[model samples]
Structure formats: structure tokens, C-alpha cells
Target: MLRKFSSLILIILFFTTNLFAQEKPEVQIGGALRFNYNLSSWKEGQKTRGGDFGYDVFRVNAKAKYKGVKLNAEYRLYSEGFGGGMLKQGWVGYDFSPENNLQIGLTQVPFGITQYNSHNWFFGINYYVGLEDDHDMGIKYTHNDENWMYAIAFFKNAEELRFGSASDVSDSRYSYDVSSSADGLYRNKEVNQVNLKVARKFASGNSKHMLGVSAQYGGLYNLDTEKTGDSYAIAAHYELNAGNFNLKVQATKYKMNPENPADQDSEGLAMTAYGAPYLVASEATTYTIGPAYSVPVEWGPISNLQFYNDFGYMNKANDMYEDSFMNTTGVLVTAGNVYTYVDLAQGKDHPWVGPAWTNGLAAGTPDAEWETRFNINIGYYF
Candidate 1:
């Protein structure tokens, strides 16, 4: 940890020295810290129970600008959020034109329709977004100006980097009887992605309304076995300040591959099972919608605070939407309205114990729907 901190300082120093080397030092640094507590209620049998806790998130961003050229770097220091972590984001980008730019290094893939949000609308729905824990160490090109934006990129599969040799395609495995080993350190599975996004905003009266659409495609390039996934999201959000009323709405649709037989094994199978046969295709789709309300505080110690509430409903089109898995301790965490637990596997309806790290559970079923999660959070930011 000490080494990491020292290295980070050195990197910042190097950038600062070089940044001031130029005359147009448009350097800017800013970030936010938010701590929130959530009270969860779950539905099981005929009883309803609740859970509570808190998490802190600290984020920072540093940027430098020179005319049309801009460079950005961001990091997040977190304490027990979705999964506890000091993990952060590090990327370097350059804007060659107002409509186009290229970024390389470590960054999120554009496969999932939902963007990692920066606001406090936490008490809503969770969308299936993200390429597992895979962060590509490659390049991404994006073109956007007004109403339309498109992105394409190739990534070094994070799994392959940790296990496989850079020169060869090695097969690795995780979980029982599960022939598909897409979750290994050196998973040689070929992964690639392409995405397109369109958005527009309109101003009327005293409010602003925005609409957005997102689409993504992903699959392996070399593996003979068939395993692929994709997502599509459409959302509309509006803001109107009438005295003290604020309102917004968000919705999404996620289409994923159907669950495969190889994905689930009732018999306790040992690890190291690999190179299993799989069907060519399957499909699962989910839809979710919700709204948000906020009122700015105008009194006492809460003068600068904003009170907000958000709610959503998710409809599963098939078995692909239910989360049926156990905690690390072999305790079954069934599907439906469970709070305090985040269904980490957004790819399948089956449950895989979350980052909380329980015993007795394996990772990522061959083909599972991302579990559905709804959470509410109250917080204050300055």
C-alpha cells in the first residue's frame, strides 16, 4: 500500500512538472466524497426483514488543458461500497476535435448501456452493466459532437492477463461440472465489443428534458464454443424546478444470452472441468423503469443539503431475470426484493455470492442473467 501511494505521488508530480512546462496550464483538480446508509427490506416466505449499513466513497480527478487538447485522470478511494476497495480508474485521453477523441489505457468498456453514474439517485434500479472485472489495457476511439456518438475498441482480457501466457490460448476453469471456464486468470477466450449511443436535450418553459439510447455487442473471437452477450438501454430524464419540486425518470432494456445446460450443474462437480460443448445460441431480456424526486433544503444545518427519493420496478421476461444462488456460506439467497445484497453477476439470473466473499459458492455460471437489485440511499454532498 505504501508503495502504491508513493508511486501515485510520483506520477502526479511528473504530470504536474510537464503540465506547467507549457504556457497554457489549464490545470483543474476536483472530486467528491459521499457517505450513505441504506435500510434494506427483503421478501421471502411470508416474513419481511430489513438490514442497514453505510459506505463511504471518495473520488478525485485531475486534468490539464491546452486549447483543444485536454488530458484527464481520475481515481476513486472507496470504503465498503458495492464491494470494498481502494481500486481506482486511470486513463489518458486526448481530444483532437470537438466531435472526436481517442482514449487509451485502463477504462470501462462500452458494452453495457448504463453509464457509471456520478449523481445521488441511488434508491432506484440496478442495470446489467460492465464487462465482468475485465478492464482492457488497450485503446478506444470515440466520435461524438451533437446528437450521435459511436465507440469501438479492443481489450486485453483481464482474465487472460492474470493466467494465460501472452503468446498462447490456454484454457482455464472455475466452478463445478461447469465446463465453461471463462472466469480464470488466463482465460484465452477472445472478447471484443462495439457500441453506439445517441442523445438529445430539449428546453421548454422552466425545465430541461433529455433522451438517450445505447446499444452494445460482445463475443469471443477464437473459442469454438458459443458464448456471447449484449445489452440495449433507452432512457429519458427531465428536470423542472417549480418552487421546490424536482422530478426525473429513467428506464432500460437488457437483452442477454439464454441460460445453457453447461451453465448449471446440480451435481457437485470438481474444479478444473474444461473444454465442454455448448449450444450456439439463446436469449434473455429484462426491462426496468423508475422515477426520482428531490427538494433542496432551505433551513437550518440542512440549508445546503438536498433530500431525494428514487424508486423503480423491474420486469423479467423469463427465468433469466431471477437470481437463484447462495452466499459464500452455502446459504441460499433467493430472488426477489432483497436488500443489502448486490447481485454481482449481471450476466445471469442465477445468484453468485457478491464481492462480500462468502464460502461454498463458485463464480459466474456459464450463462446467467444479471440479477436484479433495487437499493435506496440518502446522502449529502458539498
Candidate 2:
């Protein structure tokens, strides 16, 4: 499959260049270096030590255009604790017209929200569960116009850095992908996924609105059983932009039914991203709400400030599984060639929030307490 896909790209490029190579290709290169400081309420020792401040990541972005053909790629390097360097996204596309285009390679999945579902740097709960801003190696077709937008995609699986059936699954990915658990109890891989997304745009006075729905269906291949099962997600979302205020509202429901051995628990499956692995609930309903407002200001290098509050809630279908929640209130500061995110985020049954280790996203500990983290991420972009 990989070889065939590669060949297809070459063939298209060759034919297109021969048919329309009248203009020179244009190229651009840029990137960023970022660092973070965090003080967590759950990390008592770290608080005693005056919080943790460290290098976050450095990334490079490259893009090129040759008539209707376009390419964009980004490579990132993170501290070893996060994950080693890896490709965030790389894709080749052709613009059929102003309203239509097709992309192939590692690209973002057209899911619940188009670009991002959260206003803060720390995305909503959906991201951790593989429902938001998730990308895979696939082909996607998109159409856009004044009144509507639509997209459909088919992905063979997540990035093929390593075979999923192997005992060790790669966690150096931008988004969560189904994989083996640390204990190796649940081992499943995503396959044959299909996604459909549509949105309607309208405006009235100073307000603009986008209302959309998304559906996704995919197969889950369990290594222990060597049989394929299925998973599906459906969502309804709305976005509003009025003057300097923006709001996002979404409701999503998802489920996974994977074929597993008798000894393994079928209630949940393992998934990983960012150098870590954990269990995800087999069935759940999620909701997200966010509101943001931007104010223009001129203070030294600062030009604007955006204040936002994003919230997410996950309700597990099984009573034995505890629900999960996350909320972030913050401001984004934009300066000349620099951006910073100042946020106070709180979570219940969330791994990143901490008191409980890897169990926050799965069955969840009954004694889980709400935890908070105050963070600031600064980046220089060029």
C-alpha cells in the first residue's frame, strides 16, 4: 500500500508538470522555537521546587506551490520527555478551482471542528480521545463556497512509522492513535476509516455563523484476536463570530467495539500519542463550549490580547467508568514575531492534570480529584 501510494504521487506530479509547467514554483520556509513554564497543584514536590520551566519544542515549516499543485510540511523536535522529533503534518494537494481541492499524505482529519476545537493551547478533551484535530495518512476531498463547505476522506490508518501489529507501537505522533497499552492488555490499530463533514455558513448584521455535522466510521484491528471490529463517532457543532466575540459549541458521541481475547477486558481500548499510552473508554458522549474575545492594544511589542474560556465534558456510557472534564481560562498575547499563552486549566480525571497517573482517561479512579495547572507558553516565530 505504501509503495502504491508513493507511485501515485509521482505519477500525478509528472503528468501535471508536463501539462502545466509554464510558471516557476514558489517556495517558503519558516519555523518557531518555544518554551513553557508550569506550576501544577497536583505536583506538590514540583511546587516546593518552584515549578518546572523547560524547553518545549522547535519546529520547521516548509511550503511550495507550482501552479495548481501545492505542498506543505512541518517537522518538529521536542524534549525527550515529550517525544523525539517527528513529522507533524506533510501533504501534497491540487487546487481544482477556488472552491475545490484534494489532499493526500499526512493531513488533518475533517472531524468535529475544522481547524481546532479549543481556544487555548491545551486542546479540549476530544483531542486526547482522538476526536479532534486528529490526522492520518489518507486522501481527502474538500469543497467550499459562499454558503457551504463539505469534505470527505478515507484513511488506511495512522502514519506508518511502524507496523501496528508489532508488540511496540510508536507514540511519537501529533494525535492519539489506537495502540497497545503499556501493560499490553489491549492491542488494537485503526484501519479503513471514513469521514464526512459538512457546514453551512450564514451572516446577519455583525454576526456570522457556521453550523455543521460530522460522521466517522472505522475498523479496529485487535492483535490478540487478529479480527477486525468497528468504531464510530457522530457530532453536531456550531460556531459564531460577532464583532470581537467568537463562540463554539459542539456535541459528540462515539463508541468502539473491538474484538479482543476472552481474558482481555473489552470495555476499553488502548491509545497513545506524545510518548505515552493509556486506555480510552469504549463508549462515551462529549460536549465542548468555548467563548473568546479579542481586544486591540498597543503596549510595547504587544498588539492584541484574546481572552477565552474553553470547556469539555466526557460522559462514559458504562456506569463503572467515571466521567472526565477539563476547562481552561486564558489569554493569548500577540507581539511582533512572538506569541504567548497564559492559562489556568483545571481537570477531573485527566492524565495531564495529574494526581492520578494513566488511569484518568479510562475506567477512571473513583477518588479522582480536580487538579489545576497554571501555565505559560512563549514562542518566537519567524
Note the Cα lDDT for every prediction shown. 0.38, 0.91
TM-score of decoy 1: 0.52
Q: Could you tell me the lDDT of residue 193 within candidate 2?
A: 98
Worst 10 contiguous positions by lDDT, candidate 2: 160-169
lDDT of 2 at 146: 93
TM-scores for the candidates: 0.52, 0.94
Q: How would you encode candidate 1's per-residue C-alpha lDDT over 336-365 as one tens digit per residue?
A: 222122221121322221221111122323
Off by over 4 Å in 2: 1-21, 164-167
Candidate 2 lDDT, tens digit per residue, 41-95? 9888989998999999999999999877899899999977677788889999999
**Number of the predicted model whose lDDT against the real structure is largest:** 2
The candidate 1 region of ten consecutive residues with least summed lDDT is 326-335
Error of 1 at 11 (Å): 38
For every model shown, the clashing-pair count is 15, 0
